[model samples]
Target chain A: MADDIKPRLRVPTTAKKGEVIEVKTLITHPMENGQRKDAAGNVISRQIVNALKVTYNDKPVVNVKLDTAVAANPFMSFFVKVEESGTLKFTWTDDDKNSWTAESKIEVA
Target chain B: MNTLLTRRTALAAIASVIATRSALATPEQAKEWLAAQAKGTPTEGKITLKAPEIAENGNAVPITVSVESEMTEKSYVKAIYIAADGNPNPPVATYEFTPLAGKAEVQLRVRLAQTEKLIVVAEMNDGTLYTASREIKVTIGGCGG
Candidate 1:
């Protein structure tokens, strides 16, 4: 199993009401595609994060379903419209059913 | 007529193989995938796919998929699927969006086994479909190798 998993985000802490902001996220993972062979020529099993879900103030914003073709240390960026001050939560799930969560707060004036 | 078309395609394939000096994925499988993934006949507008014309590295090719929409509760982009024809498995990702997303745009990185075509199909809240694609040339394969 891959270790040292980490999640990173770049979100503006403040925004005007009804403003559209970009949310950039990056997670550390090997994203093993199961296509590689070790020194012994044995096939490596695939291990990858399969999904990412984002919710704003408990309302769903977006959910991305990942596949083996996604590169390692998956990175994504998307836009969100903030109307109020609330928390934006992110969840990433892997093939092993392991999940990591992160959150960012954006204050809207 | 069919035979003539087949021969012409075969000739083109040979020419392409010689130019690249490697085997590549034909557009057939990718076209079939696009057709199958779409809920219905997808139109040619409302969506845009951006990628480098020539990706220096295939392991991490950046791409952006954008769909035109007002992003309201009644009308918005519901889902988007991306696939690369040259990969062992074409599917790259599927993104689902709600009105809260405000804009139906996403940037992602994908692995491409070789030079191939990337296709994207989007489904809207109203059940309409939009499609777009791009051809990316890869200098090195991104698969396990």
Candidate 2:
């Protein structure tokens, strides 16, 4: 019953024209790599987010590949130059073929 | 009596290896992984990797990587790769960027099995390679806790 996975994002609602801004995103996941054992000494199966994609105004911005070396509850921040008002979409895909998404809009003057 | 003693010694050796096991990736694994991506030996400049000298926890060690890039259609950082020599896997993450990004910088947290060297490599659009690294001392292992 690992249905508590969720995506959260922090993006500024507005920006000056031609201003560079930062976008932060986080997701809740165990990110288990199958190396750790419990009190009973049983190996935990590996489960982690495999990739993350970000698009701005329907154009690709960044593509990230996540591996077992990434910690649990992944958090990432990147820089973007805003030229006009548009929407930013973030998609996170996991090992189980599950994809989660979060979006935000920015108004540029 | 000699046979029994030898068996006991063998078991102890195995146990010691397990207890001291830090990471699955060896030092060479990290190099091989980097070599596979880079066309030649990458020079050590253009990218700045910031990491704690002593990380209290190995599960989430905060790191920030910034590279000098104009982020224009002509010249920009095409991709950045991160890996640790002392992790279960050498390849940690790869970030591909486009001209839309104003800069080539990012911040995130990573898992490290123990005290080891963390490496970051950057590939420019013109096929130039740049890299930087830092050593982090983790008090607790990445998976132990």
Candidate 3:
């Protein structure tokens, strides 16, 4: 019932060759520590997005570890030098062993 | 005798009220929280994330990210994600962009709770995830407060 784990990406739908571009990505998650107590004093189970992998045109680009302290809806921004048209792949994993993926296309004219 | 009984009743009522509220948590409270904070689209390989080796302040620290792409219509950079490890909430911020955003780069201030690795994920126009991280040391407590 929790479909909130969807991946959100901020990408330019278009671009030009030799032009630098900015991109960002985020995911919906609670990053529960398994330490918080419910009103009934029961400890809440831990739930967090733990791993991330990024690829360009199916090539390895970046990989990261999502730790326990990351805030909810983890966000990141950066630049990429585009030489040719290609695809970007972003994947995030949660503690429940669920993984979500998103992609964007660049034209590089 | 009546005064003592009335005081006891008031205390019991207050306790019961607190207990009830705690038990009545909405089924989707956590999910709702996540949705409200969600940002950007996820991409895989068009960007780079750069962070500091050490963070002096747990409350506020600086971070930076860069990407490799051409800004033309055919090829360009897209978005970036910044997340701090060990923070109470973690998902820091998601930055959106367009091809007009020349030089895919962003610098920001963030809050960290303790010493841990910070992750930065970038998404290009074609849908990919590029990532990087650095270990930052937090001297003061930020998350517990």
The best candidate by DockQ is 1
Q: Taking the tens digit of each residue's C-alpha lDDT, what string does model 3 give over B25-125? A: 23243223333434443435545555666766665466666677666566655556666555545565555556545566765456576676666666667
Q: What is the lDDT of residue B8 in candidate 3?
A: 97
Query: What does the lDDT come to for candidate 1?
Result: 0.90
TM-score of 1: 0.88
TM-score, candidate 2, is 0.91
Interface root mean square deviation of every model, in Å?
0.7, 1.3, 7.5
State the DockQ of every prediction.
0.77, 0.76, 0.10
lDDT per residue for candidate 2 within A33-83, as digits (tens), equals 877788889987888999999999989899999999898999999988899
Q: For residues B1-145, could you state the per-residue lDDT of candidate 1 as single tens digits?
A: 9999999999999998666534445466666766676668888888889899999889999999999889998898999988888777778898999999999999999999888889899999888998888889999889864
What lDDT is reached at residue B103 by model 2? Answer: 92
Q: Write the per-residue lDDT of candidate 1 for residues A1-109, one digit (tens) a residue.
A: 4468999999999999999899999999999998889999999998999999999999999999999889999999999999999999999999999999999999987
Could you give the candidate ranking by DockQ, starting with the highest?
1, 2, 3
